[model samples]
Each structure stands twice: as structure tokens, then as C-alpha cells.
Target: MATLSASPNPNPNPNPNFRSPTDQTDHDPESLPQMELHPSSDQDPTPNSNRNFHAVLPTPPEATAPAAAAAPSLLHISFNQDHGCFAAGIDHGFRIYNCDPFREIFRRDFDRGGGIGVVEMLFRCNILALVGGGPDPQYPPNKVMIWDDHQSRCIGELSFRSEVRSVRLRRDRIVVVLEQKIFVYNFADLKLLHQIETIANPKGLCAVSQGAGSLVLVCPGLQKGQVRVEHYASKRTKFIMAHDSRIVCFALSQDGQLLATASSKGTLVRIFNTVDGSLLQEVRRGADRAEIYSLAFSSNAQWLAVSSDKGTVHVFSLKINGGSPGIDRSQSASDPVTSPHSSLSFIKGVLPKYFSSEWSVAQFRLVEGSQYIVAFGHQKNTVVILGIDGSFYRCQFDPVNGGEMTQLEYHNFLKPEAAF
Candidate 1:
């Protein structure tokens, strides 16, 4: 009953235009790391060309026979307690399959004029929301349909003037961002709750649930390089300008303590403190120009993964400690910048390790158990499953790690190599 939505690839390039003081700190160009060549980017004279470069695409597992010929395009993806499922919204309707088994379980052909686009699942209630529309000018206005998986029927329909960019469900309420406005709706009766005028064009929406209380809304504004975290109950707003270019995609940590934002012009993934909007860590990987399309945090918040347009997902481990000593204290007391350490002395550290295979990923999610990360490719229509360790599991998921995978296999896979 879990629903997943396949939206357009927010990151069309792996190198995003990220703006940071550190980016402009002025490191000599000659001191930068050397570029490595990979099969995917052998011709490109840039770093990150060697990251996750595959010589040949692997063969599909025999279990995926039914969908072998169907052009693989991700429509929606979700994880249940045991298994992960991906649905492809095609011309007929939608199809669901198990991530590990790669076997088809359900297929519905609604015959409701093809061109199905956005898909989402209401986690708490197990409802599926589907949007039917495309970019074609001839396409009719977008429409939203809620499907009751228990009965496998369309339970409700909401029509919109423009395409529905993103949707999130919080308890009895549904929040949707379309074009320039955000709408809050009561799920039970489908009544309009509140409509807020958003400054940037709303491209994505994520909600964190608080039992019986209001949820926190995370809105990623297109081309604005801004993310707004609003406490619906308190009506308080925290505006985070993390990236310099348009923020293509972002993901919130499971515990709601950290937020990861990736831009479309640079390769840096910026992590921020959810409570105070402070910069925690700056994770850098890939070519400086790789466009990051999506990002997600593991269930344990120990790991973060970023997917890009160049077809690679980079993973980083999050390290938390009492803040580092003051910059002046670390140096000499006589340093001109030396100052007394304030009460706020601690900082969080995020370190980037390496990236996985190269693929054009649109969106990704972590499974419930945190064993694997699913990344959906906009170009291949295939889901690339990368084990936290390094083993490659080719299935239909996004290219990002869903959450942290703590299994022994993953731990062993990610074990540090001995230094020379």
C-alpha cells in the first residue's frame, strides 16, 4: 500500500552552482586534485570522471522477465517493512514490483489517457496519489487522484490549474506545491485548510510528522537556492539559503536534525543544522560541474548520498562531535583573529568518501530497514540499487541511498582500506 512518486529529475547536472565562502576562499587552481578518467567520462578532462564508471551495463536479472522489454521509466517508489516496491506510470497505468525479487506483483491499466507523471504514497494511511499530466502544451490541466490500495479504487480526485510539482501527506492533512503556491488540505474530508503564497516557485515538498501536533514543512524553491522550513503549528519560518544556484533537490534527516541541499551547478552537498540554520558540513565530490538531482539521509542519519545528472551517486558519512576548538584557539593565542570562545563552540562534521556508478538519477529513497539505497534514473527508466558497502544491486530504485544501512554486509563493504 505504500506509494512512491516519480517526479522529473531535479538535478540535470552533477556539478551544481553552489555558493559558499569556502568555495571562494581562493585555493590555487594548480593545487586542486588531479582528474581521473572513467569509462563514462573518458573524454572529459575533469575530475570525477573515474567515479563509478562502468565499462558495460550489467544484464537484467532473469526474475525481471515480465518487464524486460518495457522501457524502464520510474513513476513511483516506496519501501515497506520487508520489501521495497517501484511503480512505473506508463501509457496504460502503473506496475509494481519487488526490489529484491525483481518480480511483478501488481499492474493496473486505468486507460485514463496516458502521460502519468507524479506519484506518491501516504505513509501513515497507505494511500496512493497519482498525477496525470506532462509538459506538452497540448496536455490538459493536471489532475490528482487518490487510490485506496485496500480496495484498489480511486477514492478522490483533485484537479489543478497547473502541473502538481510535489505532494506530501502529514497525518490528516495533505500539502501540495504547484507553480507558485502551496495548498494544505484536510485528508479526511478533502477540505482546503490553508494556502500560503510562497516566494520562490515550489518544486518539492517534504513534511515531518509530529503526533497530534502540526508538521514541519520543507519547501525547495526552484532556481532560488533557498529552502524554507516552516513550523505549521507555530507558523514560524526559517529560511535557509544554502546553495548559490537553483536548489534542484534536498532531503531531510530521519531524526529531523540535519538537512542536505544540492544545487544544479556545483558538486558540493551542503548539510545544515535543522534547528538553527547553521552550516554543519560541506560535502564535496564529483566534477565541479556535475548536477546533483536528488539526495537522502539514511534512517540512522549516519550516511548521506547524492545523485546527479551524469549518472552517479556520491555517499558521505556524517560525523558528530562536540564542536571543534575555536579557529583562534586551534592556532596561537597571539593570532590577530584570536577571540574568546563563545558558548557555541561545537560543530558537526560531514566528510565525503566516494561515489557509486554513473547514471542519470531523478529521485531516490531509503528502504525501511536501511539495507539499501534506491535511485531512479530519468534517462534509463531503471532503478540502480547500491549497497552501502560497495556491492551493486541492479533493481528499480533511485540512485540515492534511502537511509543508512547498518547490516554487517554494508559495514564490511564500507570497511576502511589499510593505509600503505
Candidate 2:
């Protein structure tokens, strides 16, 4: 396999003492904490006096050429075991490539259909779910199709109540969250297993397998600032609340332990404990408002990659301390001694920043057992491989240092010869 690797930085802490003393307090800042201030008398006198701030600005030629040369424009990108593929969904259907060689395996066309909107892989069965629907009249609903990769045949059609926004494949079930409700169907027979109603239109849906017979739904509702989690089998609501100015996106760890949420308002990303619905860490980046559209965790549950509206992918490492920080429920009780209440404490860790870049991340996945390869889908259908610095990765599960993703492998899966 063709691999792109970077030496892991031994010390991930670019700013160890970066936290302000005020951050330890419970209150969030109303405005940006003053970094530096100048009196009116010191204000710039001329129109060009603020040139200090523009000193490093890139020239137009440099700006235009850099972005154009970074990577090829893509239609869609996905990651498999050792390969990553990019498809030009509109013109030619799909292409398959080896991640390491970056070599074209095949090029297939599904030109009869207009294009593909979403492409997802069934982790358990190794099937591909291609959803096609857009503003174009030629490509309306009923275009959703599932293909068997090994056999290379379109074996099934997925029916949805409304346009399909997201599709998640669990061990034995496929959950499709549409405009109104979430439908869970058996992957084997495509039989409806359960349906979940939503308070607001769902913008995103993520299913985390709980290993036994349970699955957790982390959904971002269309209404401003709404997010919820529901236990599918028990039909029990787990957690629901407004976390951001506009809840644009949310994601759950594969193990169903951690939940990462982001908003369209700015650079704030919050992590919560899935077991008790308690806030664990809050991360803020950049000074201006930014919209986060996608979030993903590596399969091993150690790193989180967040993509914003500005086309930037910010990656962070998950760190867990040995002991859980105790929560004081006494503040909420009318009678602390007599109230039927109990407090819970669990492990706590700092969610320090690991890596950041201007490349927009649409989707990301980690290769199982391969700590080096972390694949991500980018804007304009491109994919970029990143090298995770060693210092920034720490496993939250049993061993705490196994989450370092240091390499990337890209494959082109869509081929013209394959059935579209």
C-alpha cells in the first residue's frame, strides 16, 4: 500500500500553559478575554497604519496557486481497510485506487443516474450504500442503491420516507435518518426493525453500537440548538438539550462512550460523557465564528477530527485520567440529606488540541489495527492524509497511548468499468 507518513511530534503540547486561570471557573466568557489593549491615543493614525496586521498576508498569485495545487478536485471519497477512493460522481461514476500506490485500479461510470449524494460502507458486510438525490430533476428519489463490492452488483434499493440525509450501518441493522424520522432495518433482509420520531427535522444521525443488543442515536435536529440521544432497543430517551447556537453537527464514538458536538456559531466543540450526560471538556479555536459541519472519531476511540464551514479539519486527542471527577448534585437538591439522589464520578481528562489545518474535512475513518492511517474526505470531493504527531495521541480506553494516527492511504474505488 502507498503510505504517506510524518514523524510524530514527541511533545504534543504546543502551549502547555495556554489555559487561562478563568477557564477553571464555571462561567463562560461573555466576550473575548482581552489579550492586549491600546488607548485611543495609541490608535493608528493613517489608513495604512494597521499594516502590521497585514504584513503576512499572501499575495493574490500565491493564494490562488497554493489552493489550486494542493489536491485534485473530487466527487466523493471513502476509506476501506488499506485503500481510499475518490469518485467523480457527476461525470464518471466511480474509481478505485490503492491508498499506498495512489494507482488507479478501475474507473466505472454510472452515467444513467445524475450523480451520487452520499456514499457509505457497511463495515460488517463490506457493502456500499450509494444514495443519489439532489436538486436536479433527472435524479429524484428512489435512486438510492446498495452494491455488493466483492460481487460488484447492485443488490438492493433503499426506500426512504423523505430525502435521506444520513445512513449508518450497525452490526446487523442499517439506520437511515431522513427528514422526519429514523428508520432502523435489518441489514440481512432490509426489514424495518424500529422507527424513531424526531422533535425537529434531523440534520444528522449517528449510531454507536453498544455491543450487546443496544445502540445509541446521536442526532442533531434542524431546529436551532437542538441535539438528542435515544436508545433504540429500549425506546428510552437518553439525553436531549441545546448545546450550541445552532446544532449543525454531532458524532458519537464507535464504542458509545463519548459524544462530540459542534455548532455553526463558532469554534467551540464540546465533549460529553455518554454514560451520564455530563459535560467533560469544551474546546474553542479561532477568534471569529465558524460553522462545523462534520465530526468523526477514529475507530480505536482516541482521536476526534472536526470539520468546519471554512473547510478546516481540527484534530484532537482524547486523554483520560485515572480517576473520575466527582459531580456535586447537592446544589440542585432542595434538601440535600433527604433528597433521593446520588452523585457519580468517573475518569476525567483534558481534551487538548492536537492538530489543525485549513483543509475541509467532510468525513473521516481510522483503519482498524493500523494506528498510522487516518483517512478524511475533504471539500470539492478531495481527500487528504494527515500524520498524527505522537505526542498528541493517547488512548482513552485501557492503554492510553495507542491512538496515534501517523499515516494516510488513498484509494480510488469508483471505476468506469464497474456497474453504476
Question: Which window of ten consecutive residues has the lowest lDDT sum in model 1?
Answer: 13-22
Best of the candidates, lDDT: 1
Off by over 4 Å in 2: 1-75, 78-91, 96-107, 111-114, 124-126, 134-139, 199-207, 210-213, 221-223, 233-235, 322-420
Q: Model 2 Cα displacement at 190 (Å)?
A: 1.2
What TM-score, to 2 decimals, does candidate 2 have?
Answer: 0.55
Clashes of each: 40, 27
lDDT of 1 by residue, 1-420 (tens): 112121221222111211111233333333221111111221212221222111211222233344334443333343321124444454434544444434454444442234456555443233566665443211223556655444344445555666677666544566777777777765655556666655565454454532333466677643378887776667777889988788766776544556788777756778887567888776664545865545665454444556555545445545533221111112223311211122233321232232321222222333323334444322222444544233334423222432222221111121123111
Error of 1 at 117 (Å): 0.9
lDDT of 2 at 128: 55
**Could you tell me which 10 consecutive residues in candidate 2 have the lowest summed lDDT?**
1-10
The TM-score between candidate 1 and the true structure equals 0.57
The Cα error of candidate 2 at residue 129, in Å, is: 1.3
lDDT of 2: 0.43
